[model samples]
Target: MVYRGPYRVRVEEKPDPRIEHPNDAVVRVARAAICGSDLHLYHGMMPDTRVGHTFGHEFIGVVEEVGSSVQNLQVGDKVMVPFNIFCGSCFFCARGLFSNCHNVNPNATAVGAIYGYSHTTGGYDGGQAEMVRVPFADVGPSVIPDWLDDEDALLMTDALATAYFGAQLAEIREGDTVAVLGAGPIGLYAARSAWLMGAGRVVVIDQLPERLEKARTFAHAETINYNEVPDVVLEMKLQTDGLGFDAVIDAVGAEADGNLVQHLTSARFKLQGGSPIALNWAIDGARKGGVISVMGAYGPMFSAVKFGDALNKGLTLRMNQCPVKRQWPRLLEHIQNGYFKPSDIVTHRIPLEHIAEAYHLFSSKLDGCIKPVIIPDAS
Candidate 1:
């Protein structure tokens, strides 16, 4: 797929990738996902998103070729590639903070390298194609156990890891009440994982009926239709007995709805910055001294946040790009122990050829699409 322009993606043929460095590996992509973050690039909200770029950060594939320096992996190994690309020897990576690695992206001081995100994240071509070039192969790609389902492996590449990381950032205690904003894949996962982290009560708020239904059914969370409620913050406050939730998460990122003017300025006109409606709501909805975990994608520009309120309330704000490889051990155990099926959220399976249509359906929220995965060989 090639990004022709904003909202102009189409299937296009590109050259098969080759190893450019000794630490690089070429993988034959088996499955790739269109992440919510990709929509930011698709809509042209992210800067330096070139017209010919391919946008995808969640993918699982089989190793087709390995460079001389590749140590742990070999040909024919099935692997899940993380969204963040990092050099193992970097200062941040030395501290296990792989997402903040200072060596990969040209603009590393601003934003670390990420696959298929945009030029801001290192303009590496993504995995929404027949093959992809993976740098720092020994440290980034993790081999999937034979028992793990391919679709499950696909989700762990980004969505599941991100959700788990968000929950971890919240630092939920026993019997805590957690409120998650948005019912998208990550939101649903965060809501469900909150229960795993000992959240006694979980409430999910969203406008989409299907996603809210998913929150109720899949995450076992109390549903809040933000569209139906007069004041979502008031509703959340009422749910928590006028205090607010124990921990609130903002999974709805730059494109969140509710404020028409902010939407028009940030989302529509590309002025000001990304909308902080959900983040603001998370701030306002949390109880005093509650933790707020943000896993949403925001562009480099500034978004107006309720810093004064957060400061006054003494809320802990924790957020970062998920260190996907770091979460693998726990997530693997969770998957193996039947905590929750990561792939259960997949609502649509699409062929790579029809991704444009799939993107349309997903972006428009048509036909109950919760999560969509692209199969390279699907006909």
Candidate 2:
């Protein structure tokens, strides 16, 4: 099924995904998820998205077939697919950076193509169907433990992986104070990851009281409602004894409260005539040597800044798309050991037919819809 237009859903039969390479395997998608990235495709923001191109990436499925030369996996294995498809032997993969594999894309691009994305990717179909063909199966997919439910493992591909990457980039340590901006699914996962990484105090900031409350209940992290308390960074500093936090994860990105200060500083040169209040607040909120990890998706161009101030403060800023392959193993182990539960982020479960409704609830943040997992075949 491909998204033909806004709020449109059409089912079309596609060629059965088959094993085309020695390292390939065919997966029968048992469960798939709709991510914020998919919302871009839904809104027609991603160019060159044709009809019948398929439109989902996050999934957990069972292997129905494997190519002859495949190793370390076989038919009947259940697995979680990584969003970024990559060949395991590329230069980037050799450096433990599988997101930038050269061969998987082979389009003169450094990074591999994502499943069901625009032409920037290889136009490979997505997993939101009965079956999906996966390349580099041994390196790109992880077998799920028998005890894990398919829904719980679905996030290993994107959300959980992204949170794990944010945690890594934040360099969270035992007893360090951390603040996560935004209480969306990704922000919730970021908080959970920080807790797993041993942050002494993790505070999730958001305008929605429902989301903040859920974060407190689910992740055992503290919450500060940005709506009620206007000066969030000030409150954070007060809670942290005027030193600000050790790490801050900007999960909200450009959509943050008027492009928060950190974003303004990062993209200062890009901002034209928008309010700079949030930008100022974010800059003042960080401790001298604190780290900021940005994982939000934004438009192509924007501007604002104080590069000299950031440089002088010696703050470490790390930003990038979530490199799914590099973080899946640790996340899987976390799931296996019961240290993290990605399923907690899901607030709604609806059949594929109600996807538009789910999208409404998700986009409007209604009924506390944090992450709604869509079951394609469920009636």
Q: Which has the greatest TM-score? A: 1
- lDDT agreement with native, every candidate: 0.88, 0.75
Q: Residue-wise lDDT of candidate 1 within 71-90, one digit each (tens)?
A: 99999999999998999888
lDDT for predicted candidate 1 compared with the true structure: 0.88
- Taking the tens digit of each residue's C-alpha lDDT, what string does model 2 give over 169-208? 9988799998887787888888988988889999888778
Q: lDDT for model 2, please.
A: 0.75
Clashing pairs in 1: none
Error of 2 at 180 (Å): 0.5
- Candidate 1 runs further than 4 Å off: 256-273, 300-303
The superposed Cα distance between candidate 1 and the true structure at residue 145, in angstroms, equals 0.3
